[model samples]
Target: MHSILPLLGATSLAGASVLQQALINPTNQVLFGSYDSKPLVSSEALEAQITEKNLRKRAEDLFSIAQEGVEEYNHPTRLTLCHTGHLATINYIYATIAELDDYYEISNQTFDAVVGNVFEYRLVLGDRQPDSVLAMSLTPPTPDKEAVFGPLVLVANDGCNESDFPATIKGAIALIKRGVCGFGDKSALAGKAGAIAAVVYNNENGSVSGTLGTPSKYHVASFGISNEDAQPLIKKLEAGDVIPSSAYMDAIVQKTGTTNIMAQTKGGDQENCVMLGGHSDSVAEGPGINDDGTGSLTLLEVATHLADYKVNNCVRFAWWAGEEEGLLGSDYYVSQLSKEENLKIRLFMDYDMMASPNYAYQVYNATDAANPVGSEELRNLYTNYYEAHGQNWTYIPFDGRSDYDAFIKNGIPGGGIATGAEGVKSENEVAMFGGKAGEWYDHCYHQLCDDLDNLAYDAWVMNTKLVAHSVATYAVSFKGFPKRTDVKMNDVSEPSIYHGPKLIM
Candidate 1:
């Protein structure tokens, strides 16, 4: 068993002594026997163990960790890759798993990854300055430490086409709406039109953040602003006002190291393992309580309850880092694995954004040809569970947006659930799940307001129960489950255009 001493190093001697007493109990000691000693856990029993109180406590803890980062950095943070809050989050998960040292093997997988670090970003329009502006990735910052200043020019449509920029737009800054194309495309179009810089504003209520997919010579310094902040400037430009604007962004894309936390049951069949995970890091916008905190904590909570019983197949839980920066951590882990190691993983399940304010029980639709052979079975597991519970469910496509991208591409079956993000709730969805129509499923998705108040408790608990049910079912048997065949690496081509939620390109 790994030592928990490191976690208690900062505690008072008396508190340390008490914890030591609690850990030394005979039941907590590792047994040197075979796997037959403990009885197998059932889905119903495991699901019963999940509670709203425990889930909320962990959510509160994550929220507090984000707040601590805010205090330490004196600004908002999303537990960005290898940052203070992110490291703290890794420590918290490690410590929690260390407490159950007798039942699981815990380790940290560290690897190199590229992440964008923003030092300073500012957007000025006339006398008004927006409080939040997200710097688009893979684009160069302003040159010579100078802001790109010019007269604001509103694009014809979404700035996806060359025709959107008039010939008179030279030396001006193009103001584009969020929909209809990739941020990179918009910036490239604006730059080709001789615009100095580009600003993409959200069409919805909250702030927006995205990437340019890859480096492009035609791309200019670009940033994303909120609807509230961009509406006034948009109206002014439409009303024939020559609004003066300036955009300055100081950021860098560099290679850095981060850790992925993994814990697996010691007694289950090691050759055929069931793996599940969620990204631990968040964007730089807010605490990311809902963006991924809910997913990470759900895995943690389920792992805690799982420690009490045995399983037929080894169950591994991962809290991945650098997911926000394009599935960096999970991709790196997959890349390092040998074919034998990859085959040992019978299936990989991912849970992200389990709780959205205007929640919909959406499961990953694994019927896409790109998905592995066994993906359909994995999808059925989740859908069947929801049906048995008399719950209304929908299907979401495998858009290669989350951690599951790596597993699916490697021909390993992958599927899971998410409430929603940035996507508007349809009236049909509203009738199924009670929330306002046309509003975002997670109004606070990747925003400053995604704190504890952002979570939907009822939905969180329901999805967490489903998580436990899946774990319990898969751990006991893969009786009818499809066998994983030798993996034929798929065409790992990058998407033509990359943007968040809705695709304009």
Candidate 2:
């Protein structure tokens, strides 16, 4: 029988650890069994029970259930936000967590929203599979048809014209595209061109449901399209089916969303606290399963395990909202914290997208800087844990993207690990990690498919490993904040709360 071999080998020979005792006496297997009551702790089951691999499987399963119960689709035909779909996604997440046997316990549900920057328009090209976003951003100068009849032709719209189109007439409405400036530019140009109406296409991937720039003076009606739908129209104009009269083009830039959920452990090291956080919110439009229902669920699962752990330092768990809103929630919380309060804080640990579908694990502490006197030490701790586990790794920078940004900004040692997201998974990555090459690190990163049906079991195994490695490493290493001036960086001074005490029951 195997338990977590005595994590501590103290000076006294008589001070045999409970874990060591259990490991030495095979008969203890009967007392400390698994969730299923199996006497023999199979190496595979150990991987699933107390290891990172097991945690990730549980996390992904919850994500799958949330995905199925939510509406992740983005439709150009229908544009909305903070609506039924958004609430549905929240409901799904709550329901999934509620159903998990006991690994997750409901803590609290606080809801709020950020000022979303962009509008998401989904245009389904069932038969008209437009190659680019420009192709599908079709528009007419007016709402009415030609005197007798006419096929829809894209109207040109120069900024000078009220409409960006050549002319806003009876049959033809103004056909405007998002370009050269604000949505107002296309609309203003279309209005000057005499367009009765218009449609624009966004050059980006996510959403732009909200207005860009500001209040508009333009009179013509308009909407934006994604790049996937806009490219075909470019071809049509080149082929003479439509004319690119008054054209506009530029990448659509706007706000997405994020959520930050935080709560202190009922018990633990309070004076020297270790903070665990990950963004629960994604690209507003996505289920954000890997981007990161995985991280969020991992923390929630760990939270359930906390009530069983008693120790020295206070542990605080927070799920950040508005991470997509440029780390807003965390920033606000940190900003509002009394300076003295900030200093009581110990290390900050973040787990973001740890289970990449492609699963190429490249982690970072503090990105290079001449002053490199920051989160680098914290980074070493996490990576060191992996090394102790006989794992190899790479490190990247702590690019203030997630909720930890607020902590780092206030001079806190912020460290985090990520599997991969949105970035391309290289051919070399496939060679090393063995997932499909050339695919985005998270195929479902901000897509509606970031649900249970899309995750790989092995990927789940990998995600949980990193998360558990980070959490467990931080847990036993709870000597309080490392001596701020102590040069023994990455050195484990004391055991974390998880190693404190255990109830055989």
Each candidate's lDDT (Cα)? 0.78, 0.47
lDDT of 1: 0.78
Off by over 4 Å in 1: 1-36, 75-78, 117-135, 150-209, 213-220, 224-246, 250-252, 489-505
How good is model 1 by TM-score?
0.78
Cα lDDT tens digits, model 2, 202-310, are 5467323223222234534444556556566656754767332222222133233323335564344455666778765555445666666677766755544443334
Model 2 local distance difference test score: 0.47
Clashes of each: 2, 85
Give Cα distance to truth, residue 88, candidate 2, Å: 7.2
Give TM-scores for every candidate, taking all chains together and pairing residue i with residue i: 0.78, 0.57
